[model samples]
Target chain A: MAKKVNSLKYEFIKGLWVENPVLISLLGLCPTLAVTVSAVNGLAMGLATTFVLTSSSIIISLIRKFIPHQVRIASYIVIIATFVTVADRFLAAWFPPISKELGPYIPLIVVNCLILGRQEAFSSKNNSGRAILDALGMGSGFILVLVALGGVREILGSGAFFGFTILGDWFNPWMVMILPPGAFLTLGFFVAGVNWLNERRAAQ
Target chain B: MKLILLFISAAIVNNFVLSYFLGICPFVGVSKKVSSAVSMGMAVTFVMVIAAAVTWLIYHLILVPFGVEILEYVSFILVIASLVQLVEMFIRKVSKPLYDTLGIFLPLITTNCAIMGLALFSVLREYNFIESIFFGIGAGAGFTLALVLMAGIREELELADVPKHFQGAAITMIVAGSLALAFMGFAGLISI
Candidate 1:
């Protein structure tokens, strides 16, 4: 509470890596781990989340005053669900393959704590400008982590990066990387790695 | 036979927490004590079963017949949110002890994602009413299994010398990764 948070810059920069929704804050982990099997899927999911998140933030911010406090969460859920439907339908129509690959996870985004969390924490309290910026920053952070995770998984599982063969012919792909464990293992290590990085940065 | 297979598939083979990553939040968040975990699991199970049956009815009876499937996400979420509220009030009125145990977790269940995922999955699988109920039970059971297992291990982990950086969420995830590997053995155990 002590740090100056009034500037718009604070809201935007916080989500990129400082307080990353996935790696740091640990708000939205379901979709983060589920669809990160490939970089493409991760990017699509991230973008879709970004759209829903930003749209809901704008609407929630505008109607923040009108929503009764007792039923505010319900209202937020409805607002979020509306945008999620829009994103889900848009994805299905424009990109069928990725949509199929992501499957229920897209609609599952409505319940993603990251989006709802931002609305409750920042959007409901802040103005629309800050809400949009917060959404963009957090969404970018989520996108970055997903792409990194998916890229790593894809490379290890298939000896390829984004569908291109990266490892040599002699490389023995860890087929387990394609399975569910790969996601948990990769994320586990990534979180530990991020912690170590922060520790070292602080030691300096 | 199909119902049995579906039940086993969702429970063990395709665990909601391990394979599908549906409810990782509670899997990692509330899985600190065996007792609380058990309570959360029961609450989630109750909601999952009911949510499955109700959402199935809503989707098939109302959304599909009226060609308003577009409202699927909105309506399903609304149903789940309100359902949790109703279930919470009912429990508080019926049993004091049970309500106290599941007090905090009930509201949180609105955002659990597992229930949402279960509803979405039943729709995707196109299970009939009975089968959907079975699937709900299986998913809830599987979720409980994962949460309780994590809780038990974490209770023991309280004494272990976890690494400095991997102490909190990191270690839990690694443990979960191992559990997932163990659970993966169930994969293809029954090809049905």
Candidate 2:
């Protein structure tokens, strides 16, 4: 029906703005805060998560009916862990430097609440087509926020963007921005900004 | 002396929550009240110690010896998930009062990432059995310290007229940033 198709489109678009995972749902803060100290690291982490999220979404959607109610959580985790291992090994074998930079985080993705949350919340209920769309939508939203966070921290903390000097000679990088405190502070402001924008849009 | 240094480093200098960002979920989610934060901290610390010991054995004994180190992530997560369940069941059987306090938080620990980070970090640093135990205590202590401090601040923050937009997690994160800045003072105390 036209109504069903429109609702599906709404589901996909919501993830980008209305239901931005990092800012709104706040599902996966561990990796979001940890890896986004730089743009590239954030991008790598986001992409790897996207691959895992989308693949796992498809698989889980397909098998949702077969998974017993009692063991569904465990089953979902196992499926997610398998894909995470693949992503981990691929990164280590190919992009050794990026892999090193990410350190344990690539493996830590196994516990990233976002991927698990998606499977539990969206994929298990929806058909494969909608599950895939939801995965891609949420993944894109996650990637966008991560890249933005990384860019803010990178430019402010290091006076660079993706390792390139963007702020020029006049700027003295705020060392704290690249440090642990900076991650929290930048995210805090970004979250506030998103909330303000949403409030204003609702008011109109 | 060496063990003391390792403990101090893990607890203060290189805190799991503040510096490494291991357990932000519970750090933010459950720190609404000091009492619950302490409860969650204890549960995590308890699991961290057991997980460290078990994971170390699995890696050094099963995975490493069998030449299947590639199963590290999968195995570690599985170990942690079941361990949380085991700990939950054990507590319910042993003490009803204790379970009442920590009952809900037990299942949530499976995805806490702090436990998994503990397992992975111990392995990464190649900490032996004894060192790993101490490391678990230290990290858990650090997590507890941060959670309790955050809870204390948030209790007062409820009274403060924070801007509406930064009311929930946003404000908490900023406070955490300031706490992190304060924690950085400990960096000079130890190099590691």
Candidate 3:
């Protein structure tokens, strides 16, 4: 029982830092880069993804035994698409503004490699509780990177935070930071920064 | 004129990769070599064209007729997955040379959001069948153009003195960002 608890803890924690789905694993880049134009958008996208990831992880874990080996990939995709549709509709109904902002990306989540990767790699092999924990960890990690990226871009690009002005008047916003190029540049530097920290920690 | 604008717009102004951020996995994963990049682009183009055609029919003929639009996502994805499988087998049987060229990238197209995004975007825009086909071609062309450009830059980037941490995917992204910025110049070309 103790060993099982420790393993679950490891599985959960790994996604936070050691195996961050975005900064480290690089599993889901499209949504991570595209929808992160603002802090709020990033937060919404992350939460929606977390909801989908966690829910699908639980369901997939529960059905692991019944899924045939040959058609597992197809089954997983259909399952994921169903959950994504639910998330998409929920967003559109409850948060029309955010749903409009995210646009097709909400549906694009159905193809997010991160969710499918977790389903295939973890949920397919693990028990329900452990799989959900793994999903939570990964989803949290994804949210962390996205929010961080969005915050940085938002603050630098427009001197705003969740639509509130954070940077002082003296600071001129880098207009490029808010553009498509900015997404790539900010993520590039941020990824390099993460790598540098990981390497330094390992060396020490 | 409108069709031409749509084709050019999808291919350049609103590139699927730079602007829409679709197919980013293959953009980063298979962009190491120019030869492979071209091959991947062609395979994706082939699949995208077929997917666009098929999904339109599925949406218009069956889903819309039956009033089951809610199943669009699930059905579209399943169709794409199975279509890719069929394309793979068809390619292997009909033309071994083409199959050899495309190799594994064909199978990888199943999960590529660019194809699905193409279907979704065309549907979202309410594009007619002809426009959807042109949109697919244009998007595929744009994806190819970006991938090849990145691949060429990466070949030269191999020798450039990139910082240690920003060596692989990081640099690739930064380069893509610049390419995206360059591609942004075309936004003023057509205002559709």
For residue A150, give model 3's deviation from the true position in Å. Answer: 0.5
lDDT (10s digit) by residue, model 2, range B37-92: 99999989989989989999999999998999989988999889999999899999
lDDT of 1 at B181: 97
Grade the docking of candidate 2: high
| Best-performing candidate as measured by DockQ | 1
lDDT of 1 by residue, B1-192 (tens): 989998899899999999999999989999999999999999999999999999999999999999999999999999999999999999999999999999999998999999999999889878899999999999999999999999999999999999999999999999999999999888888774
Q: Write the per-residue lDDT of candidate 1 for residues A1-204, one digit (tens) a residue.
A: 675566788788889889899999998999999999889899999999999999999999999999999999989999999999899989999999999999999999999999989998989988899999999999999999999999999999998887789899999999888789999999999999999999999999
What TM-score, over all chains together, does every model reach?
0.98, 0.98, 0.98
Itemize residue pairs with steric clashes in candidate 2.
none
Clashing pairs in 1: none
TM-score of chain A for the candidates in order shown: 0.96, 0.96, 0.96
Arrange candidates by DockQ, descending: 1, 2, 3
**Per-residue lDDT of A38-115 in model 3, one digit per residue for the tens?**
999999999999999999999999999999999999999988999999999999999999999999999999999999
Q: What is the DockQ of each candidate?
A: 0.90, 0.86, 0.86
Give the distance in Å from residue A156's predicted Cα in candidate 3 to where it truly belongs.
0.8
Candidate 3 residue pairs that clash: none
